[model samples]
Target chain A: MKIYFPNFFQALLLIVLFTGGSAAFANEKSFIDEIKGADAPFDNRSVKLVRPVTLETVLAKEEYQGGAFRVLARKQHIERYKCSSCHVPGKPVLVQQGFELTHGDVVINHGRKGNELSCIDCHNQEDRDYLEDKKGRKIDFDHSYQLCGQCHFRQKRDWLGGAHGKRVTNWAGDRVVYNCASCHNPHSPRFEKRFPATYSVPLN
Target chain B: MGFTKKDKAEKIIEDVLEKPSSRRTFLKGASIAMAAGSAALATGCMPSGDDSSSGEMQLRWQEYFKKHYRLMTQKEKDETVDRLERLAKIQDDIDVQIGTEPPIENVLYGYAFNISRCEGFMECVTACVKENNLDRKTNTQYIRIFEMEPGKLDPSTGDGQFYHKVPVENKFYMGVQCFHCENAPCIKACPTKATWREPDGIVVVDYNWCIGCRYCQAACPYFGRRFNWGKGEVPKEELTTKQHYLGNRKRPMGKMEKCTFCIQRTRKGRLPACVDACPTGSRVFGNLLDPDSEIRYVLKHKKVFRMKENIGTQPKFWYFID
Candidate 1:
């Protein structure tokens, strides 16, 4: 009994040390002060309590010296979307019959208003909108199928119809749905044809 | 008298030899389906080896790559075929054999029609949408049947891009859709393996799997596909909601979609609604494999051409000079 009692006490001591230590360590560490002394709200339930470092801060880090969010945004637009096809910013968004920028107008109006919410503000590394695969990753942007589900609910319906994305099921099985960004790059969405339809034959 | 009986036997043999089997019928129907339903069966079906006792098989992208339908492990493919059969039974009571075929390789399918032959009838476009179950609000048609000038190929060349008048003078009508290509750039641009080309050379989009990023739309040389900007309007009464899981399944908003060569209708043993709807027999569908088929004959002898042949996409859809 004496020998077993000492071993039991040791085991209890270790359990208390590990559990109590983790609990105390988890006691809301604040990093808002690290960045301009602002009080950033933390979700207690989540295991990821480390204060998020934004693109703004990542650029300020020693590793990312020349990374400017504004510049990156401009580059992505110029390189990816043929921005010149429509708006010159200072100029009006080009609009004609059949081709309208109505959707763009809504997004630009609601999504990007205050300078406070930049491009990366909603779409960044920590946005849990996609699966988090930071350091050891072969594929970048492991987006959750649900992330795009937040905005385009209707497409999600068509997706269920087997009309939109990659379908990985038997013809008769319960349909599996994919996320929006899987097939589309959210920045510049357009339909692509394999070949130019210059052959002007008409199907009556 | 015995010699005459031998001659009669000879005549019976000749009659049996002369009789044609339903295989010819099957071939004719199959050919029509390939072109019309290229979009629908882009993934679901391939011809398999004759195993009368067994049923159809489902194939994954990887398994599809390893074997043509005939060479596939029957156990694996049957699991899928059985599921499809069950689904078909649920949808309808007809004896539907989801037959398998060898994986179609390298060959691409495309179409080019003579606008001169087309009237103002929007049969082809309407047929495609109804056959594919497009969102009613968007009224999505994979092929855009446009009314253009007789001499001009581009619809946007001369007139105000949108004209309210119906059947304007000297205007030629053209149907433009995905030119199922051997090399599809849109497939390359997708971050996920959502949209891709099948072995038989059809570019198909998985509506359910699409992320609605629109990169594929931008990558395409022809703006054949469209995006669901909103929940497409479907009049509840008019919705022919029978969904083909891979074919004209209803599309959702934000995802990119395009014409899939009437995949749903063609995959089954039937003519595409567009083909059936055409008042003029302008569309010709046939098996490239069969030398005697009409399409094969046209391709071999006629001056067949496709859109953007210069890009080397090797489109299966073609147009003979009007």
Candidate 2:
């Protein structure tokens, strides 16, 4: 009983193999592409469209909360004001001129040996993220501290524990907190001008 | 305030005495100044436009117009230097070292920071903007401090250290700034000699000379320099009238800028803005030349480190863990 496969059966088997191979090849190529230019694309990483959309949907903002529209507004704000006209703006926190962050001596350890963060790595966005309020209304980026706590659980815990950044006591109660930029300059995060030696002069 | 020949001589003598040279040299300069002052007075007719209410009629020096120092037109450069000397209350007859002075050249200064002990108070940022006379309209902030976790390299993962309500706990704030390098890539990247390293290892940018190419911004390994997208927002009423020549001079449109370690203040025996602003005394600054300085002491005794030492910029600034 040597069963000869009909021409149709043979054709169907070929189509199945061809379609499966192509799909597998396509998937492999996508993965390969990701690995090949991974580091290079870091400089040109576009905002994740889906993630922001998802974020807006989850927050259910009456106004679009994805922050996609805010990028140009922020750029315009920077332009109109000329933030770098007097001092350098867009400088990373770690490398602004004439800045230092250590005292007399004795190094403090905060665990930056293997995995340290860059200014953009955390700041990620060029503009501020809009947050959701209790009434499902979109708030300004000024109130986006809660958005930061989403990923920085430890720092958030420390913040809650009274140890990380600024300490703004709520006028209403101790339960409320102010956002990060309240004290920190979001652009150049490091090398602050306010230090003990500069107390005589009024600071920015 | 019109000065006669006698008044001119007296002013010259006073200037010579104020310089750092020896008493003999000072006396010689004084004699020359007196002679020149007398000559101008003898010529008669004080160069009009005397604003007596403003004070003595100060002769604006011609030193700023020297052809070799910069690219300004004959008229522009002359006016600039004249304004400078007048601002400094110098008589035109006095031979100021403005252009004739030898350049200090590069002394190779840079900064290194210890990332562990900083409390993200932002005292430094505020201090710098004020001391440098940064334009407010632009919100020109020079420093960026990241609240980072232990053993982590990415600042993005850290909550910008902003998670702390006002002053948070546990996380260490790491402050980074221009590592004024011995061989600054920013300087090399500039098409003009607008930004250069000073003899004391500080890098300075000439706002007037800058073309706003922004190549230096791209070339800096530490991302130190910044560009002005618009005119800065400094209030006229709040401006610090007292300014240094290369330090915190009023800037113009479409130029690049950055921190200079408060050269005007620092060179005059004062602390940089950031060092003085740290409430925790987290930052310590001093002349590396002085062995007894607090900064030198820290460098010698503590385990100090520069950020990205592998880049080989040889920063003058140092950082230590608390």
Candidate 3:
């Protein structure tokens, strides 16, 4: 009995500490709830206290339209340019076999001089429909923001927080925002310089 | 009796009294004038052959005697709206829907302009003109987008009428409109109390009550107000039929008009036309009281400034650089 008594006291001490810690946590949670309830006066449309951004939340998958957020795949946008129609299923090598006949008119002026990226760098070799991320993960065309977010983290954060990107339909109701692909082309991401709308009045 | 001097003076006075200069004659003329005035008021100048002339006369009298929009009863407001709608149909041959939506409780409308995003597109201005049905004849544009060279924040130095292709190197764009100031000087300067700020922070002018004094226009430092020099000549196809009682309802000549933040649309939980028309997503508008709203987010997260902040207008509109 003497030998087990000290061990028993230690076990009891641990249990007390655990219960006290959990009780304090529960108290904190209820306090937050009380604050939220008090803040909302009429409709439950009080300003939500936004949590601080974390790497995990930034990298999390986006949910849109009651499904996973998606962008139109490259193949879908250009229906006329089908790889299966030109190249056979087994033939992975197509550069030497009359590449100029099909893609001669295509202009690829993207990227800096000498380090211009090729189509194969971002596109999946086996499946022409899918895009390959840096880690070789096949990504849906709709979730192209993910591919862009890998490099442009700041823009991604802004887009998520209603700072960047265009919101459509109504601002008061459902938050249906456009994806990065909707505004910019993946091959040419930079916005083109164009003539603006008609002027309000003639300049003096 | 004729031989005496006093008798002669009395005879001359009687002669003058017998003429039209007598007090009785004056009283008779005054009664005739009163009767004519009353008749004019009752029948509206001249009797018309039209079937709706009586109804029109009654409507005009009612409109003339109607109280300010703020003091009007619910029933009175309804009757006025109906009359105005009918008048629009008769005069312009266009169906206009005028809403009397009261201010939403706890909703103080706020606007945020993003300078970094605005490319001097003028899309917002065009959309605003079409939506508000501004007078195209005088080229009265409520929104004036200023193109400023970098390093200069002063609007005075910016050119509001730049015609060159935009996104000009080292130049930024900023748009200005009626701020709907909390301490609106226009309201104070109005000699007739024609203009006042609504509960939702929208400063509105009663078109019928304004006397073309231009006091409000002179009082405004931002030059946001516009005076109608002539009747607004809106084409039948161009006229915006959807309107509000205190908003875009077509104004008569010689009345002050300004942007009401698209009250007809905004009060119905829709965005202002400018906000919708902005291709660059430069404009943000919402209830300032609501913490979760987009305007609140922009106010909290962005570095915002009100134009002429030193004037102490306490404008609800804010400008920000990205």
Q: Indicate which candidate wins on TM-score.
A: 3
In angstroms, the error of model 1 at B72 is: 14
Number of backbone clashes in candidate 1: 58
Tell me the tens digit of each residue's lDDT in model 1 across B1-322. Answer: 2224435754674465346757745654665555345434533354455322122222122222221222237774565455555544443333344433322332223343555555445656666666665666544556666666667766445332223433455666666677765557788788765776654445777665678988988887867767876676655455554444345544556877777665553443234556556553456553343332334444554566677777755566777643
Top model number, lDDT? 3
Q: Which segments of model 1 are wrong by more than 4 Å?
A: A1-204, B1-110, B158-169
Query: B17-78, model 2: which lDDT tens digit per residue?
Result: 34565764655566657655754664455455544312332232133212223334556655
- Going through the candidates in order, what is chain B's TM-score? 0.63, 0.68, 0.84
- Model 3 clash pairs are A47-B292, A70-A142, A71-A141, A71-A142
Q: What's the CA error at residue A57 for candidate 2, in Å?
A: 63
Q: After superposition, how far is residue B151 of candidate 1 from its true place, in Å?
A: 2.9
| Candidate 3 lDDT, A26-72, residue by residue in tens | 55344224323333323312322122111111222675312232222
Q: What overall lDDT, based on C-alpha atoms, would model 1 receive against the true structure? A: 0.46
- For model 2 chain B, the run of ten residues with the poorest summed lDDT: B99-108
Indicate the residue-level lDDT of A72 in model 2.
10
Candidate 2 residue-pair clash tally: 88
